[model samples]
Target: MQLVVGRIGRAHGIRGDVFVEVRTDEPELRLGPGAVLLTDPAATGPLTVESGKVHSGKLLIRFAGIKDRTAAEALRNTMLIAEVDPDERPEDEDEYYDHQLIGLDVVLTDGTPVGELTEVVHLPYQDLLTVKRPDGSEALVPFVSELVPEIDLENQRCVIDPPPGLIDLAEAELDGGPEQDR
Candidate 1:
């Protein structure tokens, strides 16, 4: 499936222009006319970009057939997706799409299955992988080499070597304890 790159916000002006909240680092690659966007799976209504430009650090796009403010307003909160092939190479081996990591089985260095990756949280410092354990608990492991030693995307597994006290930190956080205690 094609990964989401942006979402259409409310109409910016009466010229069919709409504000786009960019969700990808490759914003420049996604801009321009004739670009196709899929709003949803069931809604096969592909929106063709009539014109687009980066404005105020966000993408300002106008879609074909959307001429008025009302027409643009109707597209608010619509996710923008393009058909992406899996064979497309990534920018780097360490870099991966959040979708690619989701649902992968998380394991310890010894190969003990801990849980499955439920979500990836992008923070200022680092990305955190939230693993949903079999016991219905959640563990937030930082996506660092020290913590997440290996990722076998093909096998759908990840090996982690969490730093000392990291597990206890996750446990304390799950138990509603203070951050300092963790």
Candidate 2:
């Protein structure tokens, strides 16, 4: 399986170093020195990492043969991908890879069907699960333990305990309360 590890950002300096918007949980393993990553455009790489460091809390990476700012800048927005075993699991039992959760059925605590887990949105603060509802609409559920109490991978399902309007915002709007009367 190929997983996205990071996206190339602007050139960091006159050197071939580029800032990276990291996407992987294991940056040390996937984006470290000597790691050969495949590129999204299919033409830009198999780029090998020459060196990497954290600067001002951002990841900066230098690639072999990309010798100048212009060359590094050309890689802007390019996605870096790493090859991984499909069956590989995260070291943390509580953590899950995006691929592992993508296809699971999403249901409420009482077993009410909500949707299918479609995508995992990784944000700076928290991850979100994109759910495709039966009616073809989509809902973003915060991937927090309090709301998402259980991930039954064995059954291919995720159990959520959503507050009102979290999953049914449109319906909630339709059933307006005191504010609607005003």
lDDT of 2: 0.94
For TM-score, the strongest prediction is 2
lDDT for each candidate structure: 0.81, 0.94
Candidate 2 backbone collisions, by pair? none
TM-score of each: 0.79, 0.85
- Expressed as tens digits, the lDDT of each residue in 72-138 for candidate 2 is 9999999999999878989999999999999999999999999999999988899999999999999
Q: What are the runs in model 2 whose C-alpha is more than 4 Å off? A: 169-182
Candidate 2 lands at a TM-score of: 0.85
Q: After superposition, how far is residue 124 of candidate 2 from its true place, in Å?
A: 2.9
lDDT of 1 at 118: 90
Q: Give the clashing residue pairs of candidate 1, or none.
A: none
